[model samples]
Every structure is written in structure tokens, then in C-alpha cells.
Target: MIDPFGGIKGKELTNTSGFFVDKEEAIKEVNVSIGILENKNIKKPTFLETLRSKKSKNTEIHNNVWDYVPNTNNEYVNIHIFWSKKVVRSKNGVPIRALKVALVGLKAFYRQINTLKPDLQHPDILECYKLSLENYQNLPPIESFISSEKQDLLLDPFAGVTGVDIYKKYNDLKKDKDLTLEEVKYSINFIDQLELPKSKRDKKFITKKPKFVTFTFPTSESYLNVHLWWAGQIIQTRKNIEIGRTRLALASISKFIENIDVETPDLEIEEIKEMYEITKVKHEPGKLKTSRIELKPISKGGLSYWSTKTHRWITGKYDAKNKIFNPPKQNL
Candidate 1:
């Protein structure tokens, strides 16, 4: 029987896993990412690259937006875009290509169409058109930026911390005629209203992966244990004292973990005393690469090391709790 008086607890949204694709396979990979949406040739590219670069000096694959050659009998259009990020470094004066790398994230969406000025009026390009740039961010948009189509079932695979999913990569290309999102609204619109937070089972990556416990502590004076989660559960522990500077604080924390009991009723117990050390890079994202970590167990002396690209040290602890949560405080 369940205890009706134990007050149900909720977990933070940051514990989910996220999915992403890099520049090279931007189009194809995004199409094959998770679900299949409407697939078609790009209609009109709000921002177009007028210049083309050669394969030797630059590997820009142009001509994704094909022009219908009026041969009186046939009209064929080919759709395949291959633009290189390296093409930005321009060659001397002769003007090799028009480089407009917008911060809008051109790689995220692939619906493009080039409706040139009716083949009649000849107008010069605007000055602002020549002054746009691209901005690369570390996260994706999970809150403010929304999609329009209402999926039958919505899944927020990764939680709140992502931020790069909003802006389009029109690279310096502005809404000269007030286009892009508005036009996209009619074509492949986004669906933001359908986001459902209650359906999440693991509180992170909207998947059915086995819940792993989280055990967090203050890496500093302000790191909060509240913003962290694991296996979709709240973190409850005895000590949330700050871990201080990672380099010097390791010794004391290691000693603490080596001598703690985690099977108690506290929610944050199982994170101490690891069979394998949880190594971390001084302060860099994905720098430690833990998947390749291997430890040699000698009846437990102190710690172990990953024998590869990283020479950093990390310690892992374990307990009998259902899940662990060791979150650092959310910076104010």
C-alpha cells in the first residue's frame, strides 16, 4: 500500500537528455532525428548566397535552390544544399562569393526558396543586407522558442537548460520585407501550446531509460542541491555543504565519501563511495568524456584514472537509494 500522507514531490526539469545534429549532416540528420515530419524541397530562402566557391579553395556546395530553365518542354528542379562553414574567410577583392553567415542557425532548418524580383525590376541590394553575422550559442531554446504544430504526443527529451533552438540561421539576413517566421508559419509552422510537462516520467530526456540516482553537493558556496535531479526524484541528503574549489577540495570530499553510509532513508544517500571514480574536467563541458572511464578495483584504496585523452580525476559514489540527485545551485 502507498502512504497517502507522504506528500508527492516534483523534480526539476534539467535532468533530461537532449538530441542534436552538427553542420555536415545538418539536413539529413535532422530529418532522421526522432520523428518524421513533412519533407519537401525548400520553397523560398529569405536569405540567399549569390556567390559560389570552388572545391579546391573552398568546399561550398551551392545550387540547392534550382532555377527552372524554360526549354519550352521540360522543367526540372534538383534539391541538395552543401554550404561550407570554411567559406567565410574571403579571398582578395575580385569577390569570390557573397558571405552572409547569419546567427539565425541556417543548419537547423532546410526549407528554402528563392523568388527573385519577378525578373523585371532591377534594384540594388540594401546596405544592411551586407552587414549581418552569425552567433553560436552553447544551449538550445526549450522555453521561449516554440513550435506550432500540435503533436499527438509531445516529448521534451531534454529539460530546461537548453537555449539554441529558436533563432533561424539567416546569417545576417534581416526581415527586409518582414518574412522568414511569418512565411514559415504557413509552411512548416511551430507548435508551442502542446508542450505538456506532466507527461514526463523520468523528469529528463523524455525516454524510458532506467532511472539513475543523483547525489549532488555544492561545488561552491552558492551551488544549490535543489536544481538537480536523477531518475525523476527529489534530492534529499544530510549535508549540502559547498565543495569549494574543485582542485583543493577533492581530498576532504573524497574522505567524506569514503566513510559514509548511503542506504538510509535520505534521498541523497547512494552517491557516496564509488566502484568507479566520476572524473570531471576542471571546468569545461563534455571535456572529461566519462564513457571511456575504466577503473581497476584493488579492494578499494583511493581512486582510479581513465587512460585516454583526459588525465583528470573524478570520484563516483554509490548507495541503495532508488535514485540520486547531486545538483549544483542554479546561479541567480
Candidate 2:
């Protein structure tokens, strides 16, 4: 008889009294053992496959599994595995076993989607997934997809410092009434002199107008709001020439926020005043008076109102029920 477990040597058959009573019985026992081993070797259904098999039983849970899959350009299976490991270490509410199962499901889904025909694929969903992957491929470290607390640590150079101080400094600068255009210019130059990370250095700050770059921090929104106020001041006072300067200033400030540390000082604040004086002229009776204008039908097939103050024809609304044309009220 053959040795099913491969323990016997040199084709020697065991004696009848050794294990089995007869050669036929011994051969039958060996065959039974081989069949049992083969059954053990067969692969079991993976978690992903199991989920797919029961799709009709629980639709919501199956749909929710997709949330765990990272929408990145990197290999979906690899990224998801890393993410699941991290989530486990963090002790978040998500169960490690569930995450593992979701990962397996994502891998199966990825394979299915890639193998599907283009005509059968969902165009909008596929387009969105592709865009998300492309967008994150070159994402900066400061704008990482990790938790907000981790992102703050990555953004701040100083270990203990955060965005709170930066927010306060901005508020103080905004309150200063002595701020001047020269001081604003000086602050812009100071920010420009500061070094930025290599990845951010090549971005264009001064275009036809000012181009603003967004940063992430605890007080980032507050800082941006004040920054906009400053931009508005510059626009109203200096108009177009200083527009490029404002853009450069915004870019420099963004760099400063990204590289903030304990050594950095409060950004200088200067109040911007109107450059030109305004003179109000009183209107004479004759100057305010105009000739009577004729009301003409609108070529666009609508009722028209003649604006006596502006000396122009303006569009008016017709009241279908009242059979009246309602002209807009004129300001005195």
C-alpha cells in the first residue's frame, strides 16, 4: 500500500499486524486520509467574496464598505491595508476586524471595476474617483489627508506653538490706526524674504491680480478673513498698480503661516488710509433738471420705464392682474 503521509521508506509494505488487518483495508485507509488532506487544502471564501455573495441580504453595510477605500492614485489594496493598520493603532471606534473585512471587499471591488467594460462602467462616479486620485498624487505634507490634529503638527515647525498666537497677532495688527501704505509694503517685503518649503517656492504669487494660496491651521479661516480686509483696503486706495503687490503679499503670508515657529515675530500691522481727498459738490436746480423723455417699447418685447434721474430707459415689470406697468422707485 502507498504511504499517504509519505512516512514509509523504499516501497516496503507494513506487516498485517502492524496497523491494518489486510492490504485492501490498509489501501482504503490511505485513500481516506488523502481525501481528508485535499479537503483541508482547499481555500476558504475571503471576507470580500462573502460580502459580495450576500449583497441582497444587507445592502447598506455592503455600500458603507466603500468609505474605507482611499480615493488615491496609489494601489488601492496597499493604501487601504496601511490605513486599516493605522486606524487599529489609534483605537478609534472602527473595529479592526470590520476594517479588515472592508479592505478585502474594496480589493475585490477594485478588481471588478477595472475588469468591467467601459460601456458598463458608471461615468460620473469613475470620473470623480479619477479626479480625486490625481488631485492627491502631489498633495503637500501640510495638506495631508490625516486627522486635523496630525495635520496641525505637520504644519507647525515649532513643537509647542499653534495657530492661536498667529490669530491674535493678526487681530492686533488690524486694530492699529497708524498703519500706512509704506508699512504695508515693508511687511510684504519682510514676508517675501522668509524661506518657504521647496515644494511651495515655485508657485506664482503675482499674476494679473493677486493669487491667494490656502493654508491649513486652527485659525486659518480667521487669518484669511483679515487678509481679505487688507486686500480690500489696498484695492480701494491704490487700485491696479498695487494689485500685484497684494498678491505677492498674500503668497508670502501663506508661506509664513506654513513655516511658523517660536522664533517668528508678530506680523507688523499698519492702517491704510485713503490716498485721495473727496470733494462733495452741491447740484444747482438747472443741473438737476432734464428735458421730458419719450417712453419707447422695448425691442425685447417688454414694458420700459424712462429713468428721469439717470436720463436712461430702464426695464419695467407689467402686472398681469392689475393691468399696470410698475416702474422702479427713484432715489431722492
Candidate 3:
């Protein structure tokens, strides 16, 4: 359990320091400190008993002022205390008790971090300085770095162009000494509309569809004729084949259809073979003549090889030893 503001009783604190005139002033000061904490994303204590009652012995956060665990770091506390105290000092009717209460809040704020890494000097007693308000004011708006129109085309609805992408443009615009923030904001709005599409599926945003009908016949005269003849036979016989001429022929035809765009391009080899009930050995070889083909094994010192001596794969005895599979080349 931690007490952000340690046991600084109002009566004891007033007896030692001239900061607060009375307990009322101390309450006012604590309230203002609570507001500052809330603005910095710290949650204020919500329970009614926290303001009037002491913390339970079993509780972790000893005070009832903060609802959630404070995530603030040292820099924020230093900046907050410096700015708040300066403002507090410039006003009249603020009791010395107010300052004492602020110190209590500061002590609690310091404890938020100090407990994690113990420090000898307390943040409240340390020589604190004021922060620059003008630095934050001069910083550019977040929307200035983000592109609105570019987000429309991206699949992610929240995607935006980074501010760094617009640094040169922003700097160039700033060169005009008379350029006003209002005008800059307007120009940024114009940039947001650039190249943005009205609709997701608009023709203006879509790419041109490709034409699929045009294709030149295969280069090899023998291969082209074989493919055409095989396709004709499959259309006629409609037989399925697992190996040899029928299977090879159908695979070649399917590939050709895929290469050139056609109206009925999806005719798969299996579908065509099923239509004719084509068996692997059922097909007669066409007029095309082919010499015996041999394949070298992929691995060095391996005995496995493939031969196309009879227009079908004739695997060597070493085929059992070779685990790699090499499909037969379609040279037809």
C-alpha cells in the first residue's frame, strides 16, 4: 500500500508552516490540485468515504483522492507543480493552507513514481521551475500532418498520411510572413479533398478490365498440332486418364485454355476425362512421333531416373530409392 500524500495532517502542517491560514484553504488547494491531476489523465477518487474517512489498513492506495493507479511520471509532476504554484501565488484570498495542501498533493504525486525507484530528496521540497506554455501553443495541429483524402482508397478506414510527408509543404507555406493560421487551416482542408473518390466502387477509382480472347498458337508446330488433336479426342471420347497419352494430352489442353482468355476457360482436364470415362491406357497415340526421353536424377549419385520410351513414364528401379518427384516434360 502507498500513500501518495503521506500523513500530512492539516493541523500539524499549519502548525509548522505559514503556507495555509486555515483548514478551509487547505481543502480548496487540494481540490485545485485534484483538477490538475484529472486534466493530466489521472482519475480522481470517486467514493464518498475517501474525502471524509481514513484509508483502510488493507488497502493499497492509502488515499481516496485518486480512483485509478496514477500513470504520471516525474516530468509531468514537476511541470504541474511549477505552473500550478505560480498561478496560486499570483492570487489573493488563497490561504497558506492552500499551498500546504498543494505541497501534500505534490508529495503524493511524487510518491506515484518515487516508490518504484526510491529517491533521497522529496519532489515537494526540491527547487522546482516553471514550464513554457508557448512551446505547446506553437506546435502544429495533428490534422496538419495527416492526409484525409488518401484515407479513402486504403482498405483500412483509419489509415492516414504521416505528418512528416507534409513537412516540406508546411515549411514552404510558412515562408510567407503574412500567412495566417486560418488560411493554413483552409489550405489543409483543400489538400484533404485532393484525388479522393466519392464512391468505393466508382469507375473513376477502378482499373480497366483486361480482354481475355486474344492468344497466338503455341510456337512448336508439332506440339501445337498434338495439343489440338488431343483436345478434339477428349471432346469426342470424354475418357479420364491417370497417366500416359490421355492424361498428358488433357493437361496440355487445359494449360492452353488458361494461357489464352476464352469464354469457356474453366474446362478442367479431370472434368473432360470424366465426361469420356478416359482410362490411362485407353487412348491411342496420335500421328505425332516422339523419341525416347531420359531424365537425370535431381540428386548427385542417385540412380533414380525417368524414361518416356513408350509415351508413358518408365521409372528406373532406383525410383523406389528416390524420394523426389519430377513431373514428365510436355514436349509434344
Please write out the lDDT profile of model 1 over residues 1-332, one tens digit for every residue. 78686877764432111111223333443333221112233332223332223223322223332222233132222122222222211111111111111111232322221112111000001110111112223323222222223334322111111222122222111121123223222111111111334463234333322111112542332222211121123233223423221111222222232233221212244542111122222111223436212222212332343222222233334333845422222211
lDDT of 3 by residue, 196-311 (tens): 44453345223432111111233321111122322213233323222122223333333333232111223356553332222122322221244112232323232323222222
Off by over 4 Å in 3: 1-15, 19-30, 33-79, 82-84, 87-107, 110-120, 128-332
How accurate locally is residue 137 in candidate 3, as Cα lDDT from 0 to 100? 35
lDDT (Cα atoms) of all candidates against the true structure: 0.24, 0.28, 0.28
Task: Identify the candidate with maximal TM-score.
Answer: 1
Q: Give one clash count per candidate, in the order shown.
A: 53, 2, 16
lDDT of 3 at 99: 35
lDDT of 2 by residue, 82-119 (tens): 11111101111233224344334333333333211211
lDDT, model 3, position 136 = 29
Better of 1 and 3 by TM-score: 1
Candidate 2 clash pair list? 179-270, 179-271
